[model samples]
Target: MAYIFLDESGHLYTQIIGEILEMYTPTTDLDFRVFCDQRHLKGITRAQFKEMLRTRLLPLLPKGAILQIEMIDSTTNANIQIADWITGALAKYLEKQKWGEEYYSILKNNIIGEGKELFKDYWVEAKTNKKLESK
Candidate 1:
């Protein structure tokens, strides 16, 4: 399973890169130090970030791959604003991509009501299956 933690800075592009990097290289296992550089959150609009994620990152995933997205609302930051914008934009994008109903159903069935332990189990199971299938 691929885990993506998203946040926004001055420009959406930089925000995407920063967060993705942090996820791949964390400071400590429990450090929770990942953050977008706020200085980059100046002039860029959220719409641009959403479009970039859809056009760029979305295509990189294999067809039929499932994506689980989560946002960290840290300390009343502007990143929250960007996150909200991105969330809405993503919903719209998913609909346009014709993946709305199916994706939401999966999240509701597996992750939400069932609790995070189940989510983790599902993620691990999915990842293991993907790895085996690719072998």
Candidate 2:
């Protein structure tokens, strides 16, 4: 049997099932928008969130487990804070896997940049094709 943990926000959660470690910001919570609106006001920054995740997930995670982190899709949630948290989590996971700091930094930047570029391209294409109604 695998272990799973969830935070109060419900958006942030982690699970270790079999050989895979999964972390994600789930999109199904009805109160997620309200939760996001109150994010930093509660003094819970991305750093703190990352630490909380590590504290809960690390002990349960076995060595050589594959980490699968679900980053916020720009099309659905454009919150930069969530993106930052995902990047930080990725760095920690990569380090734990002994992938080296240099590789972590490179992957982090690519993650951040790739999403933005994809959103921009999608937006331009939609506009050009008149798929999105313009005001």
Candidate 3:
């Protein structure tokens, strides 16, 4: 009787864990772009952009230690106004696209297991290009 009880409990635990693992697979990659004039590229620096991400965005991760953000590509111009605009636009896009809510769900679910670090390593490698308008 004792052995049967232990076996059943263990099986139940294993099944629960399996169900959880199955629910939160790696999220799909997201990509979008916004176009602005040369005047918009005045004040944003790469360092400041990264810092903004770390402070404004990184906290959304469920487990900071396990989940990390790796930016593969980000292009910024020297204009502060442009930087601000870009930041605001990004915030708007994320909100419009339901990223904030999805991120919250990820946190609440406590998804990702042993391979979380691997997922983090490849999370957001963006590619960007800049074009100059000819008058």
lDDT of each: 0.47, 0.42, 0.37
Candidate 3 residue pairs in clash (backbone atoms < 3 Å): 41-79, 42-78, 42-79, 42-80, 43-78, 43-79, 43-80
Put down candidate 3 lDDT per residue, 14-86, tens digits, no spaces.
3332333334434242321122222221244434433433443334334432423333322454454554544
Q: Candidate 1: lDDT of 109?
A: 50
Minimum summed lDDT over a 10-residue window in model 3 is located at 32-41
- Once fitted onto the true fold, the runs of candidate 3 whose alpha carbons sit more than 4 angstroms away are 1-41, 65-135
TM-scores of all candidate predictions against the true structure: 0.28, 0.24, 0.21
Segments of candidate 1 deviating more than 4 angstroms: 1-9, 12-40, 68-71, 76-135
Best by TM-score: 1
RMSD (Å) of each candidate, 1 decimal? 17.5, 15.8, 23.5
Q: What pairs collide in candidate 2?
A: none
Best by lDDT: 1
- Report the candidate with higher TM-score, 1 versus 3: 1
Residue 76's C-alpha lDDT in candidate 1? 64
TM-score of decoy 1: 0.28
Candidate 1: count the clashes. Answer: 5
What does candidate 2's lDDT look like per residue over 1-135, in tens digits? 533334433223322211222222322332211112123313345555444555544455555443332334344665856655566666576447555565566666665322212133765686677854663
